[model samples]
Target: MSRFFQRLTFVLAATIFAALGLGFALGEFGMFGVHAGGEQDGAYRQMHVYAEVLKRIQSDYVTDPNINTVTTGALHGLLESLDADSSYLTPTEYKIYKNRPTTGVAQIGLIVSKRYGYATIVSVIPGSPADREHLADGDVIESIGDTSTRELSLAVIRLMLEGKTGSTLSLSVVRPRKPDPDKITLTRTVVSPPALSEQQYENSSILYLKPGELTAARVDELAAKIKAAGKTRKILLDLRDVSEGDADQGIRVANFFINQGTLAVLEGQKFPRQTFSADPSKFLTSAPVAVLVNRGTYGAAELAADAVEDAKRGDVVGERTFGEGSVQKTIEMPDGSALLLTVAKYEGPDGKKIQDEAVAPTVIVSQNTDDDIDADNPQPKQGDEILNKALALLKAKNS
Candidate 1:
C-alpha cells in the first residue's frame, strides 16, 4: 500500500512538471495559449496571428493568390481596424511619405482632400496637368482608372495619384459646373508648385504674400525682398491651404515678428510638456502684421498662425484653420515598413488647445465662388478680398 501511494505521488509530480515546461516553451516560442508578458504583447500576438494566417493561405488555399496582394490586403485591414489615422506603409510608399513634407516629388501640382466620400479638388497648381486639363476647383474625383475612390482611403488615393515622373494615370473627376455630373478623365504629369506670389491691392496698404509650400528659408528670403520692395508698414501672411512641415522652420518664420515669448507647447504621454520660445534677436520686422488662414491651414502652418495670434502681434483673418495639432513620430519596422504614430498634442502660446477646435480668425471670410476657390488663377482684380479686409483693419487701427 505504501509503495502504491509513493508511485501515485511521483506520477502526479511528473505530470505537473511536464505541464509547466510545456507552457513555458509555448510562451517563449510564441505558440499555444500562453503569452510572453509585455506591454506590446497584444500587438505581437496580432502580428503572429497575421503571419500564421498568411502562411496557411499560401500553403493550402484552393486558388493561387498573389503574395504581394495578400500582404497588402492584410496590412490594410489591420490598419483600418486600428484607427482611421493609423496605417501600414510599404517600403516604397513609406519612403515617398517621408519625403513628402521635405522634398517635392513628381506631383500634378494640386492640393486635394477626400470629402463626403469623394476626392475634392482644393487648389490647382498653375500650369500643371490638372490645371492644363482645365480641371477647376471643387471638382470631385469619382474614380482612378477602374477603381472608385469613393470607398478608397485617402492614403491609397494619394499613392495611386503619385507615380514615376513621366508616367501617366487616368483620373476621372466630376466638375460642379459641367452640365452633366459625369466623370472627366485627365492624365498625370510632373508639376512643381510656386512658393511665393505677390501683388499690390487696388485700395489697401497690405502687401499679400501668397507662399504655397515655401520652405522657411524661402520665406526668409521673400521677407527680405518684401522689405526691399518698399516701406510696407503692414503685411498679410496668407497661410490658406498651407500644410504642416518642419516646426523649427515655422518657429524661425514666427521669430521674424515675435521678439520674445513662447511660440508653442508640446504635451506628450510619458513625456514632459516642452515649450518652444522665440529669440528676440530674430525679429525681422516690428511692423503690425495680419495672418490670413482658412479651413485648409493645418500643422506647422497652424502653429505659425497661433504664434502670431498669441503674441498679440497680428490679427488673424479669414476662416478658422484645420486643427491637426497632433505630432506624429515615424517608426520603421524590420521589413522597412513604417508606422506614423501620433505621439503628442500641441498647444498655442495663450494656452489654447489646438487639437479638434482649430484657431478661428478674428475676421471671418468665406470662399463662395469658383473664383474664390481658385487659389492659382485668382480673378484678375478681386482675388485678395481677405487680404484687403485685413489691410483695412490694420489701416483703421493706424488711423
Candidate 2:
C-alpha cells in the first residue's frame, strides 16, 4: 500500500511539475496567476489534496475504479468551477473542437451554457426547431441522447447539439415546475435568424427594433432602420434573446446612439484594459431611446444593453440580462488536450464585469412565469408585458 501511494504521488508531482515548467517556458503562468513563493506553495498543497482523494477512491472503492476516467472528471470539474465558459477538453475532444466543421452544420437553435453543473438553455432562437418545440430559457438539459450533460463540458454539449440538417438529437430536459426530465427529440435544421423586427408604435413616434441575434448583418439592419427613422422617432431597441454574435458587433451597436463617452471596457489579469469609445462617425441618432432586455439577453447583447444604460444614453427596461461576456484563450496542452480559459471579460461604462454583474434594467419588468403552455401552444399566457412597459416609458418621454 505504501509503495502504491508513493508511486502515485511521484507520478502526480512529475506531471504537475512538467506542466508548470511548460507554462513558465511559454509565459502562460501569468495568465493563470501562478506566481512564485506563497501562491506556488499553495498550489502544490492543493495538488497533494487531489492526489490523496484519488488514492482513496482507487483503494477503498466498492470496486476498482478507472483512475484515468476519475482524473478526467476531476479536471472537468476543476475548469467548470472557474467559470461556465472555461472547459477542459480531452485529446479526442480537442481534435473535434479544432477541426469542427464550419459549413453545412445545422442546429436546434438553443443557446446553452453551464449552470449548476448542467447544460442550461440561455435562449431559444425565434422560429427555430427548439423554439417551435417550446424549449424556453432556464430549462435544464439533464442529458443529451443517452449521455448525461453533467458529465459533459459546455463545448462538448454544444458540439453534440449540432449536426446535419434534418438529423435529430434526443434530450432529457427538466423545465420549471417539472420534477422529472421529459424526453425530447429535436430535429436539427439550418436555423435562419428572423430579420430584424421593426414596428411603429404610438403613431410612428416609437420605432421598435428587435434583433433576435446581434449578428453583424442584424446590426447593419438596425443602423439602416435607425437612420431611416430620422431624428423625430424614439428608438426602442429590444435585445431579448440576442445571444449570438461577435463582441465587436455589440460595441458597434452601442456606438450607434452613443456619440461620446465610454461604451464598454475589456480587461483581465494579463490582458490590457481596452476602453471602447463611441466613434462619432458611427453615431446615428440622438433620438430618445430605451433598450429592452430579458434573462434571454446574453453575451454581446448584454454588452450593448449595459453600455446604453451605463452611459445614460437610454433607459434599459425589462429583466436583468443573462450574465455572459468573456473572451476565451484556447491553451493546448502537451498531451494534445486543451483548455478554453477565459482570459478577459467585458465591462460596462460603470466598470462592472458583464459576466460577473449582468446588465440590470433601469426599469425592471419581470416576465410572466405562471403561464403554462405545451408544444401545441407555445405562446405565454400573458401579453407582451415588457414591451408595454418600454413603450409606456418612451411615450412618457415624448409627452
Candidate 3:
C-alpha cells in the first residue's frame, strides 16, 4: 500500500513539472502547448487568440480579406495598444525618419505647435520660406487651402506644410501685427537647411554657429569655418531641433571639442554601462563656448550638449532640453516593417539622467508670447529668441 502511494505521488509531481515546462515554452516562445498566468501571459494568450481568429477568417469567411492589409492592421493595433508614441513605420516612412538627421531632409525650417485647436507657428527659420514671405512671428495659421487646421495633429499639419522642393502650399494666416488679420497665402521653396550657418555679431567677435543637425562632418565643417573666420572670440552651438544620430558620429564630433574625458555612458539590460570618451589629442578646446538648446533637442544632440557642459568645454544656455536620453536600435524584421526598440538608457557626462527630466540650461530663458507665429509666414516678433540669447551669452563671455 505504501509503495502504491509513492508511485501516485511521483506521477503527480511529474505531471506538474511537465505542465509548468509546457506553460513556460508557450509563454516565452509561443509554442502553444500550455498557458501561464499574469499580465505577460495574458498578452501572449491574446496574441495567440488573434492569430487563431485570423486563421479562421482566412479559412471560413464569406469573402477573403486582403492578407497584407489585415496583417498591417493587426500590427498597427498591437503598437497602438502599447503606447501613442509606439507605432509601426512603413519602409519608406522608416527610411525618411531614420535619415533625416544624416541627410538634412524633411526640415521645414520652422518650429510649430498645436495651440488652442489651431496650428500656430512657434518660431520661423531666419532665412526659411516663411521668413522670406515676410511672415512675421505671431501669425495664426487658420487653414491650408480649403482644409482648416483646427484640431489637426502636428504630424498632419507638418505633412501639409512640407513637400518636395518647388511644391507650393497655400496657407490662410491671421497675423496680429497686420492692420487686417486676413489669410495670407505663401509658396514653399527649398531653403538650404545648413548644418551650420554662421553670423558674426555686429560689435563683438562672437561667432554664432546655428547647427541644425550636428553631424560629424558638419561639426568639422563648422570648426573649419570658425578657424577661417580667424576672429571669433566665442562660439555658440545651437542644438535646438537636433535629435539622435550615429553614436560613432557623435563620438567623433565630441572629440572635436572635448580634451579627453568621458563623453557619455550607455547602460542596458544585457550589457554593463559602456563609457565613451574623447581622445585628448583631438580636442577643439580653445574658445569659450555656449550651447543653445530647447525642448526639441534630444538623444544624440542632448548627449553632445551634456558632454560639452560636463567637460567644461562650454556652458549650456537657452531653455531646457527635451529629455529623450534613451537609446533605440532599429530592428528590421523579415518583412519591410521595422521596430525602433528602446534598448538602453544613457546619461550625460555629468552622470545625470535625461529621460523624463529635461536638461536645464545654465541661463533659463522662457519662451515669450511674441515668439509664436503663423505657418505660412511664421516670423515671430522676437524670432530665434533662443539663438539670439546664445549669441548674447557668447558675446558677453568674450567681452
Candidate 4:
C-alpha cells in the first residue's frame, strides 16, 4: 500500500509485459524470437491473473510481504518461462553492470547456467580461482556474497562474479558427492584464458592444439599456429572446456577447415534470418583434422564442432558438447542500466539449432565416470582416454 512499494511493483509489471509484447511482435515478423508463445486471449488472461494475485498480496497478505521480492520473482518467472536465457534487469543491478569495464571485468572464472533455480557451474577456466579450488563442473552455487543464487538470472550471476581485482566473492557451493554445501571464497582477478597451445602426442606426428578460449586475439593465434604446423597432415584441435569468446571467432575457426560452404545460420525475432557462408579462399587446411570435444565444450566451441561435423572436415571425438549458441544484445536503459536479451539463436550448417540440439560427436567416446570432467585437466593424468582415442583414429586414417 506504500507509495515506494507500489511504484516498484508497477515498474516490474510494466517492463515484463512490455518485453513480452515486443517479443510477440518479433515472433510474428520472424524477427521476434523466443522459445515460448501464446494467443492474445491467453496473454490477456494471464495478465489478469498476475494483477489480481499482486493486489491480493498487497492488501491481505500476512507480515506486510516484501513487494520488491514478489515483483522480482514475478519478473524472473515471466522471462524465464519463455526460455533459460531471458531475464529482467533491475535498475540497481543494471547500474553495477554498466559501470564495469568491457575488458577483463574481475572474475573467479566459472561458466555457469541456471538449473532448478540455482547457478550451476558449466565449466571452469583453467588457472582461475574456481579451478584452483577444484570447483568441478555441475557444482551448484547456492549463494554468492551472502545472497542465494537460487533466484538470480544468468546475467545477474555474471555481474555478481565481476568486481574490482582482489575483491573477494563468497560462495556456498553444493558439490557432487558432498553431503553439505562447502563455503568457498574467491578473489576477483583478471582471468586471461590461454590462446592456442600445441603438444605432439608421444611419438606421433599428430599435433594436439588447445585453443583455450576462442576470442578474436585467440583466433589470430590459431591462424599462426595452423601456419606453423603447415602440412602436419594430422591435427587434433581440442575444444573441450572452450569458451570466453564470441560466435564470430567460432566461424573463423571453422573457416580454417571448411572451404566454400554455409558454415552456419542465424534466426531471430527482430532480425532477418541470415546465413554465414565460408569462402574457399578462407579455408586454412584440408588435412585430416580431428576435433576433441566433451560436455565442457560450449558456445563458440560448439560452432567449431558443428562446422567440422557438417563439412565432414574432421572427426569429432569424445563426449557431446554443451550446446550454447545465442547472441546477446545488451540494451542500455534510460536509468543507466541495461537489458541483456537473447536476440538470436545459432544453428549448425546442417540446420540443427545449437540451443536445442547439442553437437554430438561423430565417434562417441564415453568415459567410465560421469563426474563432470574438466577438459583442461583430465583425471588419472597418465594414459589420457579421449586424446588416446583421437590419436588412434587419426593414426588409422593415415595407415
Q: Higher-TM-score candidate among 1 and 4?
A: 4
Where model 4 places Cα greater than 4 Å from the true spot, the runs are: 1-13, 22-38, 202-204, 331-338, 367-383
User: The CA-based lDDT of model 3 is what?
Assistant: 0.59
Between prediction 1 and prediction 2, the one with superior TM-score is 2
Off by over 4 Å in 3: 1-31, 35-74, 77-86, 90-191, 200-205, 226-232, 241-253, 270-273, 325-337, 351-355, 368-399
**Candidate 1 — which residues are off by over 4 angstroms?**
1-85, 90-104, 113-122, 133-142, 150-156, 174-182, 201-204, 229-232, 270-273, 325-327, 334-337, 350-355, 373-384
Number of clashing residue pairs in every model?
Answer: 1, 0, 9, 7
Predictions in order: lDDT? 0.65, 0.82, 0.59, 0.76
TM-score of every prediction relative to native: 0.70, 0.90, 0.59, 0.86
TM-score for candidate 2, residues paired by index: 0.90
lDDT measured at residue 97 in model 4 versus the true structure, 0 to 100: 65
Off by over 4 Å in 2: 1-36, 369-382
Pairs of residues at least 3 apart in sequence or in different chains that clash in candidate 2: none
**Judged by lDDT, which candidate is best?**
2
| Local error of candidate 1 at residue 163 (angstroms) | 2.6
- In terms of lDDT, model 1 sits at 0.65
Candidate 3 shows a clash count of 9
* Better candidate number, 2 or 4, judged by lDDT: 2
* TM-score of candidate 4 relative to the true fold: 0.86
